[model samples]
Structures are given as C-alpha cells and as structure tokens.
Target: MAELRLMKGNEAIAEAAIRCGCDGYFGYPITPQSEVLETLMARMPWDETGMVVLQAESELAAINMVYGGAGCGKKVMTSSSSPGISLKQEGITYIAGAELPCLVVNVVRGGPGLGTIQPAQSDYFQAVKGGGHGDYKLIVLAPASVQEMYDFVDLGFELAFKYRNPAMILSDGVIGQMMEKVQLGDYKPRLTNEEIIKRYGSWATTGKTADRKRNIITSLDLDAGSQEKFNIKLQNKYKEIQDKEVRFEKIACDDAEYLLVAYGSSSRVCQKAIDIARGKGIKVGLLRPITLFPYPSKAIQELLPQLKGILSVEMSAGQMVEDVRLAVNGKVNVEHFGRMGGVIPTPNEVVEALEEKFIKA
Candidate 1:
C-alpha cells in the first residue's frame, strides 16, 4: 500500500529522491530551497542505502559533482534556487553536451542579481531555453504543488535516462515552502547496478578494463561538421520529446468558452481565479502545463477551435504568453496578466484582472 503524508514540497522531493533510488545528491544551501538540503540531511540515506549526499562548496561545485557521478552511470541530482542555478549553467551545458542523465531542481527566486528569497517565475525563459551558452535544452518539469514536487523526481530521472540528457524540476519558493498532503508513491527502484552496467557501461567510466576502450566525456568539437552532427542528434531527441513527452492538466475545458493558461504556482492562483469566475456565472477554465519544455502546444491548439479567448496568468512579466499566442495560431483572442519580482497575486486580484481584461466587455 502507498503511504500518504503531509510534507512541504522540499521535504517531499528529498523523500522521493531516496525512494526513486537516486544514487547521489550534491547541493549547497540556498533560501526557500535550503529545506531540501535539511530534509536530505535528516533522512541520512547515506547510512541506509549507501546513497552519496554531499554539500558542495558552491553551486558550481555541486553541479560539477553531479556531472562526475552521472559520468559513472549513477542516478544523481542537485538542487538550488535561482541565483545558485545561474551559477550551475556552465555545468548544465557540460552535462547536456556529454549526453548524461541527471536531475536538477530549481526552486526559483526573484531577479537578475541577488534577488529576494521569495518565489518568482523569472527563470521560465532560462529553464525552457538554454540557460548556459550552448545549443541545448533540458527536460523542464513545472510542479504546481508539493505532491507534484515529489512525483517529479521519478519523472525527471525517467526522462533524463530515456533521452540520455539532463532533466530539471522547475519549481518556485511557494511550492517549495507550502505544506500539502502527498501520497508517497509506490517504492519502485529505478535501475539496478547490474542494469546500469548492462545498459550504459560502454560510456560510463566505472573502471579501467582490458576489454573496454577509455572513455572521455566532453562537449569540445574542433570541426564544425562534427559539432553540427552532435547538434543534429540533440535536436532530433528534442523533437521526439516534444512529440511524445508533453504533460498538462485541463479543468473544465471541454465546455468552457474562456481559458486560463498558466503553470507552476501561478496555475494554483489561476485555479482560484477560475472558481471565482464560475461563481459570477462566467464560463472560464484552466490549462496547466506540467512539462514546460515539451509544452502543451497541441492541447492549446485544439482548444483554439472551440474557445473564445485565453488569459495567461503567470508570475513572470509575460514569458509563457508568447508560447500560448503561437499555439493559438491567431484563431482566438489571447491576453496576459502577471506579477514579477517575487510578488504573488491573490485570487481576487486575478479575478479582477480577468474581469477587466477578458470577461467584462
């Protein structure tokens, strides 16, 4: 039987990582996300499962540690907030270039500099697009609540190993800090050492052996043609993911005339907004994307043929709205409402914005 428990998002992630058979975790403490480290520390998976947990000197070191472990075919992970993630970009690029499997969690915070410790969605573009200087994409999963935070660890690792690429859990401070009821999913171990050796043994530097060739994992391509070939492979993989890996949630969309598109914590706010709109006899619905990178474009496009308008409520200024617009194909009116710099809007605020901009003529 599966166990149900009340946990904060950060705690859930730590628990899920252990249950998922994650081989190692390397991270430093950062606000809003510091609880992840604390939880993992308290659990002490190292003593029980022999899983390695290290608090690196910095975010850069933590990510590099992840790269080191992944290169050895270990199910590794790292977590940080926005600024710490910014520092991990270089390491992320390195991991992607090497076609390694690892999980990264970014509990977002405000801004370009030393932003506030509060939540912000400003990292949407960074997470969806390549944060580092490269032609690469990370499998980005956006979690709306504490349950998804736990659920996403298994999902993240699965996607990473499936594509031989890095995967990220793109959460924010609110989700990380909020307490919620979560179902501790069935304890299913992801991969055995024997399985790892059988599948990824050719490249992973487990040890030197006379039967195998030396492996050098790197992104350095001297020849343009060689670099292009690598890029082509990555692009092909991304296309496959786009086609088969997208996941999202739809509420009251089948009979709705107006739709609200949002993700992460903002989607929760939109849920409240939908309830308010319905209370006033306005026919509104919601489409929440769980996989932000393999965005629910097809779903949005399908909705366009039936819905009259879409209001995208986000915590960023307007990053996701552009994607919504493109998916709609100019078939219907699409508008945006947002707040930035770590300011979370209340349900009433969202309702008023919807009324002024979308519902009330």
Candidate 2:
C-alpha cells in the first residue's frame, strides 16, 4: 500500500527519491529548497537503501558530480534554488552534450542575481529555453502541487533515461514550503550493478569489454562537421520529446471566452481565480502547463478559437506570457499580470487582472 503523509513539497521530493530507488543525490543547500538536502541527511538513505547522498562544497561541484554519476548509468539528481541553479548551467550543458540522463530540481526563488528567497516563476525561460547552452532542452516538468512534486521526481528520471537527456523539476518557493497531505508510492529497490550494465551498457560508461565495443560518453568532437551532425541528432531527439511528451491541464475551458495561462504555483492561484470569475459569469478558463519544455503550444492553439484574450498570471513580471502569446499567434489578445520579488498574487487580484485586461477591455 502507498503511504499517506503530510509532507512539504520539498520533503516529498526527498522522500520520493528514496522510494523511487534513486541511486544518488548531489546538491548544495539553498533556501526554499534546502529542505530537500536536509531531509535526505536526516533520513540517511545510505543506511536504508545504499543511496549516496552528498552535499558538495558548492553548486558547481554538485552538478559535476551529477554528470559523473549520470555517465555511469546511475540515477542521480540535484536540487537547488534559482541562483544555485544558475551556477549549475555549465555542467548542465556538458551533461546534455554527452546525452547523460539525470534529474535536476529547481525550487525557484526571486532572482536576477541572488534575489530574495521568496517564490517566483522568473526561471521559466531558463528552465524551458535551455539554461545551459547549445540546441538542447531539459525535459522540464512543472509541478503545481505537493503531490506532483513527489510524482515528478520519478517521472522526471524515467523521461530523462528514456531519451538519454537531462530532466528538471521546475518548482518554486510556494510549492516547496507548502504542506499538504500526500499519498506516496511504494518503495522500489535500487538497481544492482549487473542490471545497470545490462540496461545502459549500450551508451553508459560502464567498461571496455572485448565482446562489445567501448562506450565513450562526451559532448565534444574535433571536427566541426561531426559536431554539427551531433547537434542535429540532439535536435531530432528534442523534436521527438516535444511531440510525445507535452503534458497540461485544462479547466473550465468549455464555452469560455477568456483563458488564464499559468504554471507551477501560479497555476494554483489561477485555479482559485477561475472559480471566483465563473461565479461572476466571467467565463474564464485555465490552461495549466505541466511540462514547460514540451510546452502545450498546440493545446493553447486549439483553444484560440474560443478565447477572446488570455491573461497570463505569473509570479514573475512576465516570462511564460511570451510562450502563451506565441502559441496564440495574435489570434487573440494576450496580456500579462504578475508580481516580482516573492509577491504572490491573490485570487481576487487575478480576477481583477482578467477583468481589466480581457473582460473589461
């Protein structure tokens, strides 16, 4: 039976990692998400499941460790807040270049450089648009609830290994610190070395054996032509992921004249605003994006015919609004309303923004 517990979103991430048989977690302590490392420390999963949990000296070190672990076909992950996530970008790009599978969690805080430790969706572009570099995409998953925070940890790794790409759980402070009753999955055992060799030996840096060719893991090639070909291969993989993995939720969209587009914590706020708007006959619906990279562009385009305009509610000044606008392609007016520096907009505020930007306009 699955265990039921009241767990903070960050804690749920840690607990779920252990339950899902994560091979290792390497990260530095940072606010809004520091609890992820802390929970792992207190639990000592090394004692329970032999999972390696290490707090590296810095965010840079932690991400490199993830790169090494991933090359070896291990299920490794790292967690951090916004600034810390920025520090990991170089290594992230390297891991992507090598096509190593790993998971990253960013429980975001306000930021432009060590900004407030308050919740914010400011990292949307960084998360979805490839924070590292090159033509690569992190299989980005946005969790709107504590339950999703728990569920996505496992799902993120699955997708990562499925495509041999890095994945990210783009969470924010509001969800990280919030407490909720969560039903956790049953425990899964860590894969043994033989199983790892059997499964990922095709690409992972297992060992050079006579019976099979050696596996070399890297993102570098001396010839520019070779590099271009590799880049094209990566692009093809990204297209496949985009086609097969777009996930989102639509609420009250039927017969709606306007839509609210948001993700992560902002999506939760919009859900409340939708009810209040519907009560007043505003006919506002919500399109909550679950996967940020495989963005629900088609989903938004499908609703363009019904939507009068879109009021994008976010915790940042405006990040995701660009994507929403691009999805609508001027078929409808798209407006943005948000608060920065950790300010979370109230449900009433969202309704008012909708009224001002779409309904009243």
Candidate 3:
C-alpha cells in the first residue's frame, strides 16, 4: 500500500526523488524552494538510498553537476527558484545541446530579475520556451498539487531518459510551499551500471568497452554544416515529443462556451472559478496543460469551435497567452488575466476576468 503523509510540495519532490531511484541531486538554496534541498539533506539520502545529494556553491555549479552526472548515464536532478534558474540557463543550454538526460525543478517566484520570493507563474515562458540560449526545448511539466509534485519527479525522469533530453518541473512557489496529503509510493532502486550500459550504452559515456568505440558527450561542433544537422535532429526530436507527449486536463469543457486555460497553481484557482461561473450560469470550463513544452495546442485547437473565447489565467504578465493565441489562430478571441510579483489572483478575480473578456465582451 502507498503510504499517506502530509507533505509540502517541495518536500514531496525531495522524497519522491529518493523513492524513485534518483542517482543524484545538486542544488543551491533559494527562497520558496529551499525546502527541496533542505528536505533532501534532512533525509540524508546518500546514507539511505545511496543517492548523492550535494549543496553547490551556486546554481551554476549545481546545474553543471547535473550535466556531469547525466553524462555518466545517471538520473540526476537539481532545484531552484526564478533567479537561481536564470543562473542555470547557460548550463541548461549546454545540457540540452549535449542531449543529456536529467531533471530540473523551477519553483517559480516573480522575476524579470529577482522580482519577488512569493508564488508566481511568471517563469512559464522561461520554462516552456527555452530560457537558455539555443535551439532546444525542455520537457516541461507543470505540477498543480503536492501529489503531482511527487508524481512528476518520476515521470520527468522517465521522459528525460526516453528522449535523451533534459526535463523540467515548472512549479510555482505556491505548489512548492503548500502542504497537502500525498500518497507516497514504494521505493525503486537505482539502475545498476550494467543496466545503464545496456540501456544507454549506445550514446552514454560509460567506460570504454572492447565491444564498442569510446562514447563521447559534448555540445560543440566546429563545422557549421554538422552543427546544422545536429540542430535539425533536435528539431525532429522535439516534433516527435510534441506529437506523442502532449498532456492536459479538461474540466466541464464539453458544454462550456467560455474556456479558461491555466497550469500549475493557476489551474487550481481556475477550477474554483469554473465552479463559481457555473453557479452563475456562465458555463465556464478549464483546460490545464500538464505538459507545458509539448503543450496541448491540438487540444486547445479542437475546443476552439465550441469556445466563444479563452481567458488565459496565469500568475505572470501574460506569457502563456501567446501559445493559446497561436493555437487558436485568430479563430476566437483569446485574452489574458494575471497577477505578477508573487501576487496570486483569487478565483473571484478570474471569474470577473472571464465575465469581462468572454461573457460581457
């Protein structure tokens, strides 16, 4: 039986990493998400599950550590808030370019630069649209609840390894800090060297063996033509991911005339707004994208015929609204509603936005 426990989202992430057989965690302390590292330290996973948990001098060092561990075919991860995630962009780009498999968690706070420590979804663009400089994408998962915070750690690793790419948990400070009941699953053992070799030996930098040529891990190609080919390969991989991995949840969308699109903490708020709107006979529904990178674009497009309009509810200054618009393709009106700098908009406010944008308009 799964163990039921009251856990904060950040703590759930840490515990899930251990239980899911994560090989290593390297991170720096950042507000609203520091509990992730603190919980890992308190558990002493190195002693318990033989998972290597280390505190790095900075976020840069932490991400590079993940890059190094992932190059060795290990299930490594790191966690940070907005500013720290910014510091990690260069390394994240490198990890993507190298086609390394690892997980990154961004428990977002408000930011253009050190904006606020409170919960906000301002990092949606950074998380889904490649905050790093490069032609690359992270498999971004937005977890709305503590249970999902626990669940996506394992799922993130699975997806990361599936494509030999980096994955990110695009959470917010609210999800990171909120306490809720979580069903903790059983422990899974880390993959052994033989298993790693058997699975990833074709590309991973395991020790050179007589059966095959030495494996190389790098993100650089001096030849422009070769680099372009590599970029095309990456683009093809992203298209495959988009085709196969789009994940979302629709609530009361079947009969709705107005749609509200959201993810992470905002999705929960939207759910409440849905109920309130239905109470007022507004016929509002929510479309929550669980996979932000492989966004539910097709799903949104399919609902376009039924929806009078879409109000994108977020904790940012309207970042994800762009994707909603792109998916809608001017077929229907799409507007944005948000609260920034760590301010969370109430369900009432969202309903009001829905009324103003879709109902009254």
Question: Which candidate has the top score in lDDT?
Answer: 3
Model 2 scores a TM of 0.98
Preferred candidate (lDDT higher): 1 or 3:
3
Q: What's the TM for model 3?
A: 0.99
* Model 2, span 192-274: residue lDDT tens: 98899999988888788897898888888999999999999999999999999999999999988999999989989999999
- Tell me model 2's lDDT, rounded to 2 decimals: 0.94
Local distance difference test values of all predictions, in order = 0.91, 0.94, 0.95
- The per-residue C-alpha lDDT of model 1 at residue 269 equals 91
Q: How would you order the candidates by TM-score, starting with the best?
A: 3, 2, 1
Candidate 1 residue-wise lDDT at 31: 93
Off by over 4 Å in 3: none
Ranking according to lDDT, highest score first = 3, 2, 1
For candidate 3, write residues 1-361 as lDDT tens digits.
7799999999999999999999999999999999999999999988988999999999999999999999999999999999999999999999999999999999999877878899999888888889889889999999999999999999999999999999999999999999999999999999998999999998888899899999999999999999999999999999999999999999999998999999999999999999999999998889999999999999999998888889999998999999999999999999999999999999999999988876676
- lDDT of candidate 1 over 95-192, digit per residue (tens): 99999999999999988799798899989999998899888999999999999999999999999999999999999999999999999976666566
